[model samples]
Target: MITVKAPGKLYIAGEYAVVESGFPAIIVALDQFVTATISPSDTFGSIVSKQYQENSIFWRRQGDEMVFDNRDNPFHYILSAISLTENYARETGQALGVYHLGINSELDSADGKKYGLGSSAAVTVATVKALCQFYHLPMDKSKLFKLAAIAHLSVQGNGSLGDIAASVYGGWIAYHSFDRQWLHLQRQQHSLTELLAMDWPDLKIELLTPPADLRLIIGWTGSPASTSHLVDKVAMVKAKQRGEYQTFLQDSKACLKRMVQGFRNGDLATIQTELRQNRQLLQGLGDFSHVTIETPILKKMIQIAETAGAAAKTSGAGGGDCGIVLIDRAIDSTQLLKQWAHEGIQRLNLNVHTVNDDVISKA
Candidate 1:
């Protein structure tokens, strides 16, 4: 048996703007993960999840609004990973074999509620990693990330693949999305193996090291947000307000640039300052788009964190899920956490998972 795990991720600064080609976001890999375990099957191959009682036929709409039923599917992401990896394997002159794959996730609450910790991204990366081991394929970090990103985008079809980068590379990373338009154009002409080796324009992933005095605090709002839904809402509304959307993208790009520099220079104060700016930017964005980027509970959570002398903001596409706080190590967070507890907020016990840490650990 072979088991592999990929860590979940949170967007520390850039959120809505990261979806644009070449736009940047700062994301960190969290301790929670999705694990994929695979073993050879002599008779029939199957995909299963510990969260589901049975493996059922899966279906979803495609570009032309056509629905297709696939029996091998247990989940969209896991199925995408399996299909793409096998395609890649065949493109590389490798024969296929049957296997049974099982998935388990830690990116959710005990009751099976999502934490919005990029569960799909983690699972896709984990599935790809596990299959690589099963096939005796050698892949470096970059290659693995490219493969996982492709698989994820095939299913989700939106957003920046920064979560995929965070899962593959681990730890703090400054990610700029590649040009999906260019990718779409190339897909018509290139094989899976060819696409993996090609240069993806504007795609950048830089690992960052946090200052020693910087402290990151995460608070869960007990509500899950659909990132795709939020992104779609913004897109629909932003069409009518192109000028403001453009400015938001430029400002976000510059803010994340400074935050990345802060990490490089060990400047905790600048990092916090930029974080506050990012929060305000996101709020303005939410206001303009009329989408609840920060729900009432998340807003309350941020207000408390800021009162505690920390810079706070909604972590991902907002609506709900988790908020992140950046504070100096010298500040006392006791009162802040106490107040959060009074409001039913749960502080998550999560830390950065570095690339040196295990992206795929054997069990």
Candidate 2:
């Protein structure tokens, strides 16, 4: 049996802007992860995920495709991962055998609420690694990131793939979005195997070492966000208002630069200033796009963090999900937690997964 683990992620800054080409976002891999275990199966392959439900999906190879026994399955990501990995193997002249797969996650609430911790990306990365191990395919982090990205984009047509990168290579990362327009056009003409084989030198993914004194607190808003819906809304706005969108992109780029510099120099004031400015920028985006990017509850949480002399902002395409707070070591964590609890924000006790740590481990 082979087991693989992938961590979920949080975007510190550059959320909507990172969707544009050449814009960079700072993301951190959380300690929480999704684990995939693969072992040999006699008749056919099966997948069981506790996070999805109590159902098991049994599937087998049908010509070149993986046909699951159930059609209306929620675990489309697992199927996509298997299908794409199979295609990759065949294209690279590798053979694969049947295996039973089990996926478990620690990135969810005890009562089954998702923390908006990029669970889908974590699972997709874990599945790709497990499939690679099952088929004895030699894959480094970069290759694994590409393969997992192919599977993710197959299921969900749009994303920056920052979560996928964070999952494959655990740590604080500065990432630039890939050329989605080019990828979309290429997908129409090429297969996933062909796309993965191509080189994408323009996609920048750099691992960063954050300041030791930097402290982070993750607070869940008890509401789930549809990232696709938000991304599409933003995309429509960009299509109609290209100049305005460019302004947002430029402003976000400047903010991200300052934030990165702040981290490097241990300048808490610069980091805090950028975080608040970026939050205001996202709020402006919500107003411009007519989509509520930041909800009232998320705003209140940020306010609470700010009152305590910390910088807070929504992590992702936030209608309502998790908000991140960055503070210095001098701040009172206990007092902050009490205030957040009063505001109905659930604090998630998670730490950053650093680059020195292993992303995939034997379970």
TM-scores, in order shown?
0.93, 0.90
What's the true lDDT of residue 96 in model 1?
A: 92
Model 1 over residues 1-363: C-alpha lDDT tens digits?
998888999999999999999999999999888889999999999988876444354457787685754322338888889988888878767789999999898987777777889988898899999998888776777878888888888877788999999999998999999999898899889997788888899999999999999999999998877787788899898889999999999999999999999999999989999999999999999989999998999999999999999999999999999999999999999999999999999999998887674424221
Quote the lDDT for 65 in model 2. 100
lDDT by residue (185-288, candidate 2, tens digit) is 88789876677777774688888777776799999999987787789789988888888788889999999998888877878788889999999889888888
Worst 10 residues of 2 by lDDT: 354-363
Measured by lDDT, the strongest candidate is 1
Query: Could you tell me the lDDT of residue 57 within candidate 2?
Result: 54
After the best TM-score superposition of candidate 2, give how far the Cα of residue 254 lies from its true spot, in angstroms.
1.4
lDDT of 2: 0.83
